[model samples]
Target: MKIKCSKILQYGALEIVAIYFSLLMVMSLLTGNLVYRRSQSLLAAAIIVVLTSHLYSDRRKYFITWGALGTLLASVLYIYYNLNDSSQVYLAIKYLSFSLNESCLIILTVSMLWQRTKKFILVLLLILALIIPIVFWGYYLSMDAWFASDTLLAVMQTNLGESKEYLSDYFTVSGMAAIIFIVIVAGIVWRNMQSVLLVKEKKHFTAFISLALLVSATACYKTRDNLILNTGWKAKENLQKYADFQKMQAQRKSIVRLNLQENGKQQGVFVLVIGESQSKDHMSAYGYDKKTTPWLGEAFKQDNFIKFTNAYSCHTHTIPVLTYALTAKNQYNELQLENAVSLLEVAEAAGYETAWLSNQIKYSAWDTPITVIASEANQQDWINHNIGETTVSNAYDLKLLDSLKSLKLTDKMLIVIHLMGNHGSYRERYPRDFAVFSDMSSEVGSYDNSILYNDYVVSKIYEYVRSLPEFNCMIYFADHADAVEEKLGHDASKFVWPMTHIPMYIGFSERFRQKDAAMVNILRNSQDKVFTNDLIFNIMLGLMNIKIPDIYEQENDITSTYYNSDIQRFKTLYGQRFVREDLQ
Candidate 1:
């Protein structure tokens, strides 16, 4: 009796050890000295697994094995399908692996509790694991129509519209056939899983459950990856952060009353273009060796255009940089930008019809930071997909031309066009005919070609507005620039000069600068001044001849006579301080 009790204790200890190591593998940062929270929970679950199997006199662990395998396969397929575009393939793989690791943790934990859960409950769990990929089909399907990568910001709160945004694109005969094939394969895998986990003996069932838990946990921790994997169970974190961030943008009031003035004809159009992953260093207009931007180059030569030589993005990533670019926020007053009226709000208040047109994901804006600014635009519509990042797309920027044509000419109108300009997997950005740069390797050549294509798109937009009446101006700047060579691409941990030095120029119609010659000179004189994009909110206001209250700083505005150019005050997003020469 004494010997049996000791052996039983040893058996329990081994089960606990397996779960403990597994927890450590996924969560290396998880620290616990005196107590083991994970160990206790796991031990309890293991005991439940044992007792439940014994009570049922069942040798079958159908739920555990089948569910885990199904989930594992589902997760892998989901990732393969939805991976976003990355200039650095390694970064793409790294994030994919991280997300998969979290799925494994879920699988293991779920497997251990399968039999303990009711049959109906288990079925629900199985369906959930199976459906995650389908939930993304909407975005992926539309992507094939024209597509690319996007992040959590792109996945607004279980939005069915977003989930099925590409349904029509994927439901074609061939697409339906592919879906049928997947369903068949899934059925087979689940059936096989049942057979594989079936046990004829009760002892075999208990031992298998215990050993499987222990072995899987230990092996996971023993691998080269140092930290334990995070569960990341909370799926809507980005949506929540977006909500919290927006309240700050709408709620804060710095002035007793808002005031705005239209410096030009209140009857003209102002187009502000927000470009993605474009760098000034690569643009011909900015004097790169390659003529990557012939259209912009010609525009630069025109006296109506004022190109800035030292403009920087506030952050290297899209969300952070654009949050400030579209609103009145900077690196210093992050807290204040919250509740600050965005450019669209100001434009609307001034009785302008605001329109936002993007070749990016639409559903992402519903709950992300982009929504606040986009909400200001009466015509803001999504034109892209939240599909996997690296998928090739033949969709061209010119597709937006039709939409722009529809807006027609309007008085006191503000149009914002967001382009998927020169983002990675660059070959997909342009049609094969646009591939003009030949001497360089395909990677670099593809990038330059995308820029060239961008030049065409920008010129088309300029020509359209050029035909419009009154004092109209067209402004183009990148959300943030990319270092095409960096392994993590532009969102690297450290600063690289090229990543923040994006192309920015105000292309005024012949009529716009003529409205006030002194205004043009003020815009031209501030050309060489060191500017950060976070000041875009203020810049947008100033360009429209809108006078902000005395509260907001004027130094960030290019059109302000008081625009600041103290070399000492300039700083990049990565905290590197620079002067005029440093920018060069």
Candidate 2:
């Protein structure tokens, strides 16, 4: 059967566009993550196919066969990208765009290579068939999570014995079935190609090659900043990142000198209590109608204890917010996370012994930047032994206090306590005795009860430290809050006021407050200022009175006299949306 050039162009271009949109629309509806911008990219790709349709004028059979195959390959890759669980909608769409671009590049490269030499045709078929096993593994991973750079990094860290065990666990009956299916499909495709032998007959050169280049250029242009989401690209990128992290780890050994100018305390027990999913709106000390924070309410009466009413979290998630909060990276800064200096490193540099105590899990299957930072501390204790986001534990925040008590005392100390306060499964967060709002069976009631329990835990920590002879300073802050009204946690996609409006407080011993009266007064006055958690790194330094001139921006330090509160324009989610707009 013979097909006209006009018919080929009309059907080929139209079919490609139709299939692209149909896959995108179905995946978008299923995942509920893709945004409108992805559709624009897909449209651009379809337009490139239409404009470059004349390239196939000379070789109709070759064009039709390769075009159909490329579309199928692209669709499979698109579905694989959407399988990721934690990726943002914008990022998911970007990954989908990369899949489209990758498929186009594969078609262009393979066609050109086969046209030049017929010997590697069978080899190409084998390589193409290998995609089935790769996709099957991806599908298996998506049942729990999806492939990421961290996944590759985890595999690299594992021993040979562990790797063998891990592979055997996933090599199920279905996996074997997929392998068999791909072998049959590859045989059929190879036989069809052998029957046609179209590459031997292709004689036209200039027009086809010109169109191919234009199509490749279009694909590259549309794939800006999205990057490839496949395992191979991610592994290469993560290897570079891991290398950079190793450099940062090496940099942590040397002592960094700071000219405090006779202003900060270098010898005392400084306690930083990091709360979880705790919103100021639900706390009595922050003017909630309920007595969710009764202990804090009483503590507010004392001159040493002060609460920052307008403080917020930089981001609406645990990892990103804490990553910035515990480092020099701020919402306004252009500093890369890998290059940023963590609080533990700074404390160690200042000649203070640092301890990290957490009620959260110690390890994740993927890369845990928090765990990396936490491990840098001189002493570390993690109460929860569960793995990553997949598992949940009932380890109470009080366990952190027990861990803190077990640590050996040092003269100059920095103790960081990470509490599991009010993180999802709110009912499970508190003890039976602390379920004060049990009579009221609403989600808000459960959340308030968790806050009540957290209040007790914070007060107990304060009580324990106050009993100590060494001058003590305690600062309590949450990573981010929850939006109970919408039944959503701190999801970046669903931005809300409660997610950022976290609870924050600082208390000093009488002796220390008398000595550092100037710093205490500055902090007291800045209580009402619009403070974000990202600026906490500088403030912690200020509390310790360790002044690294280059690293510490006084404008970002709440304890500094020059602290700026004019950052009403500061935004979250990498400055995509203004946080002030969500502030009620």
Best by TM-score: 2
Model 2 agreement with the true structure over 56-79: per-residue lDDT tens digits: 433445445445444444444344
Clashes of each: 15, 1
Query: In candidate 1, what are the lDDT values of residues 361-410, reduced to their tens digit?
Result: 45444455676678767885555664433223335777787778887456
Each candidate: RMSD? 9.6, 8.9
Q: Which segments of model 1 are wrong by more than 4 Å?
A: 1-239, 245-267, 334-338, 380-395, 493-495, 572-584
CA displacement after TM-score superposition, residue 320 of candidate 2 (Å)? 1.3
Candidate 1, residue 319: the lDDT equals: 71
lDDT of each: 0.60, 0.68
Q: Each model's TM-score, in the order given?
A: 0.61, 0.67
* Superposed model 2: Cα runs more than 4 Å off: 1-243, 252-265, 364-366, 388-391, 439-441, 582-584
